[model samples]
Structure formats: structure tokens, C-alpha cells
Target: MFKTKWFSGGFSGGFSGKLSGKLSGKLSGKLSGKLSGAALAGLLTAAGAAQAASVSFVQPTDGATVSNPVHVVFALDGMKVAPAGTMMDGTGHHHLLVDGKPLAKGEVIPANDKSLHFGKGQTETDLTLPPGDHTLTLQFGDGAHRSYGPELSKTITVHVK
Candidate 1:
């Protein structure tokens, strides 16, 4: 069982300073094997892609049904978030995918066209989606909007009504 909690506290000029992220839960030996299996699956999913920062939604579950103006939370592992021009290697911002294919590795993901980029290390946001089913994915990109790579993203499904 993997349990997690998210809270917001300090922000410098609308950019998140630190995230009070907490993870609790026990992974049985069997569960550990499962995690490794899942990791392998992800690697297989992106057979040939650039390295992108991995992200996950802390507020909503995949295929969750919710109202518009949804709150989305982003999480990144093995990277740091910085300004657009100050991004460092293995660190970057988050991009919200509305309904599109996964971005190619190293390809610069545009902030426009249903894509949302948080280059200032923003951790949360309220999004208003039109009533419909949408695929939500978090792609962490460098200062240049290039994907951290193919293995660092989290994809989920959400329905707005």
C-alpha cells in the first residue's frame, strides 16, 4: 500500500518554494516486485525516447470523474524545477497534457495548444476543462521545453462533467 499526502505552504511570487509532500505506506516484498515490474513496463512503453522528468498527479486518480476547475498536483523525481532559462540538467518544469500523444524525447513541448508549462517550480494549479473525457499527462521539460526524456512522465485519464 502506498499512501501520500500533499499540502501547500510557502511560495515566492507565485512559484512554489518547498512542497510539503508526504508518502506513507508499506510495500510488501511482493509489492516491491510489482513496482519493479511496473518500472519495466514504463521503459518498454517508451522504447526509444529522450529522458523526461517523471511526474504524477497527487489530487486526482486516473479515470476520475470530477467537475470543471479541477485541481492538479505535480510531482517530480530525480529532477529540480527552475526558471525557464535557469533550468539545470536532470531538472525542469512541468507540462500538462490536455489530450495529445506523449511528447517525443528531447523535443521541445510547446506551452500553447492545450499544453500548460510551469517553469517556475509551481506545484499545484486549478484547471478548468471543458465537459468531456480528457487524457492528462505530466511531462517535465528543461528550460527549453525539451523533455527530460521518455521515462520521466506520468499519464492519467480524467473525465469532466
Candidate 2:
């Protein structure tokens, strides 16, 4: 039987299994029922924090003026870029959040015109933006498209001429 003691907004017992490292408190017991949403969230957060990673723009220096069809390049450190659906530790693909804010932790990064997905492990891309000022955020997401949070993201501002 799996026993879990619920403390104030945390677990204070023991659970045996893969969740041992994800939880805040100690876990000791046989695997049991499904984990609650909170537990799953905690696990995801812990997983995201396991590595120290960073993403940045390699081209179009910040605050630079550019023309249409802007060329964008992405750089990553402390992790490997892998295609989506490839679940490997210290690996993930890049996402270009064009003029958008960072996605919440464990949140699924949306796919749209602004939110570009590099599921194929692309390191760079070309974007066409209207004449104006825009922000480009480079975010890295896990194989499942779950965001690694802002800690793994880089934002830059550019002016289109």
C-alpha cells in the first residue's frame, strides 16, 4: 500500500518509484494510484529545473534595424537540440515566440503564426514582419512541447525598416 501524507501544499511522506526525485518531501511506499494534477505539475517543474540551459539569438543584434524577411538565428548552451517527440534528457527543440511573452512553466507552447515550432530541430529561421518594432523570444521546449519556462528563453527587440 502506498501511503502519502499531505502537508501544507506539499507532500511529507514517502513514495517509491520514479516520482521520488520530483516531490518536495520524501516518498516511500509501493506505487499506487494516479498522481494528482498538482503532483504532475510538481514533477514537470522539477524536470525542467534539472538542467541549466539557455537560448539566444545569434543574428540580428538586439536593437538593430533590419529589412523585411528578417534572418534569425538561434543559439543554445548547456543542452542539445533534438527533434520534437524525441524524449531524451538534456535535449529539446527551439520555439520562436515572435512578439510574445514567455509561456508559463509546464505550459504547452502554442503553435500559430507568432509561436513558431521547430519540431525538426531547426536552429535558424527567416521571418517577415511589417515595418515596426517587434520582439522575438527564443524559447526551448521539451519533446512533448511543454515549455521549460523563461529561464530557458531569450528575448530581443528589433526594428524593421
Candidate 3:
């Protein structure tokens, strides 16, 4: 016999060894294998077209001038911000796309100095940029870090003072 813990969905129970393999397969399929490659790309594209989710910067208004160490704030609608690796429907984390275009559908957002990943579900951060005009983008990604594309992103321009 084995014990199970379920969250985010209405699933709760304990089962014996006889059901382990079947349950494992089903859960694994749902979590990872259900959609992939081109199919996943198509699904992501369709979801973007169908849904009206959006992310926006709350602190620095577009075209505004600011000082160094800019404070960035993120706002989201039509979805919830969940930590990375949490595969719940209609939930995802944030990524900061600095002066960069959104990642293609089904493309994983890279974790680097330029492409910032807030896998911890952070809604705000402070960034130090060179004294000049720069564009900051708030991009949302799914549990697996797959980009939600431009449809779920917002970009703003700010000038450092």
C-alpha cells in the first residue's frame, strides 16, 4: 500500500500496489507527455489566441524616466502566478525579458542575466541598468518554463536618469 497527497485538484486517496503503475503512468502522462513538440506548440499558440491573459509593469510607466536600480513590478490577469514546476492549469510564473523579444511558442525561457526567470513566482524586482533608455518586458511562462509568447507579455520603455 502507498499513501498519496494531492493538491490544486480534487483528488485524494490511498491505493495499494496493484494501482501504482497505472496511476504513475496516468500522472506522468498528464504532467509531461500529454502534449509535446509540434503538438505542444500548436496548443500553446491556440491557448494564446483563445485566452486574454496579460502581464504588465506596475512601477515604471512606459516612456518614463527613472534613476538607476529600477524597481520593476509585475501584474497579471486572467491567470494565477504559481511557482515553477507546479503544473496546475491556468497558473504560471514570470520572466523578465530585458530588451528582448518573447520566446517562441513551446520554447523554454532561458535562465540568464538577460532573460531573467522568476521561477519562485516573484512579482517584483530591482534591476541596475546602464544609464540609457531600455525596454523591460514581463513575460509569463508555464510550469515547465515554456513561453506563453507575446500574448502574455508586456513591454515598457524607460530612460535612466
Candidate 4:
């Protein structure tokens, strides 16, 4: 990692890792999508924190209001989605933590209703929840279902009417 950075080191220090990741992801996303106006603004406004991987909501966007059986979508950047037990670098699966918090790195995401695992590499689902305010966390996990840490996750709020 250090040697690779030294070669493409745009800026120096630890900041380079974060800056490069963010800049690369942004540039690639922009060049591929070619978005403009509000759409570009929306992409810029999306909350992302992963240095090498990012998992976030694609549908029912953050702070969206909706009904039960919400149309949920998952988006990933800088990483590839694979089925559980694949055990490959830069690859993992998504997990929807409904009304749950982000798990620590290497921590096993519990098996329960709140923690919905997408071991088959699912990117979207129709989530049925009670009518009320809820917090949704999009988490990524390795083949063993161990979390990739908070940086690889995103949390959003939704109001069910």
C-alpha cells in the first residue's frame, strides 16, 4: 500500500489515501454518468465515507418519506459485490440493518430481523416496516458476514406514512 501510494501520491501524508479515494471515485462516477445540474448536485451531496469502498442507499433516498414495503436500493462504489463466502479482496455483500447501528470491523452482523443479510449479493429489496420513523443502515460484510466497519456503511432516515 505504501509503495503504491508513493507512486501515485498526489498529495503527501495520510490525507492522500482519503483524498485519492474520494477524488478517484468522484471522477469515475462523473465521467461515467455525465450528470449535470441538480443531478450532479445530488451526487455531490450524497454522504459517503469509505476510503476504498462505499455502500449507500440508491432508492428511497436519505430522508425520504414512504409507505410500508419501501422500495430499497443499494449502491456500491470502489468495490465489487460478491456472494457471501467468496473471500476475495475488494469484494463483499450488502446487509440492510433496519433500525440498527453500524457494526465494528470483523464483528459478525447478528442474525435477526433487524439485520437483513444479502448473502446472494442482492442490491435491492422491498422492505416492509411498521408505520413510523426509522433509521436504515446499509452495511457491507465479507464472505464470512463480518462487517467491513462503519466506513463501508451508510445510514439514512425514512418516514413511513
| Number of the top-ranking candidate, with TM-score as the measure | 4
What tens digits encode model 2's per-residue C-alpha lDDT throughout 13-98?
A: 11122334534343323223467533644454576533355778889899999986788878786666777898966678888887
Q: What TM-score goes with each of the models?
A: 0.65, 0.68, 0.68, 0.69
> What's the best-to-worst order under lDDT?
4, 2, 3, 1
- When 1 and 4 are scored with lDDT, the better candidate is 4
Residue pairs in candidate 3 whose N, alpha carbon or C atoms collide under 3 angstroms: none
Per-residue lDDT of model 3, residues 58-143, tens digit only: 78999999886677777786567888898966678888878888777678998776788777777777787878888888888999
C-alpha lDDT of candidate 2 relative to the true structure: 0.71
What is the C-alpha local distance difference test score of candidate 3?
Answer: 0.70
Off by over 4 Å in 4: 1-51
| Pairs with backbone N, CA or C atoms under 3 Å apart (clashes), candidate 4 | 85-143
Error of 2 at 28 (Å): 35
Which residue pairs does candidate 1 place in steric collision?
Answer: 50-149, 50-150, 51-148, 51-149, 52-148, 52-149, 53-152, 54-152
Error of 4 at 110 (Å): 0.9
The whole-model lDDT of each prediction reads: 0.63, 0.71, 0.70, 0.72
Model 4, residue 134: C-alpha shift (Å): 0.4
User: After superposing candidate 1, which stretches have Cα over 4 Å from the reference?
Assistant: 1-53
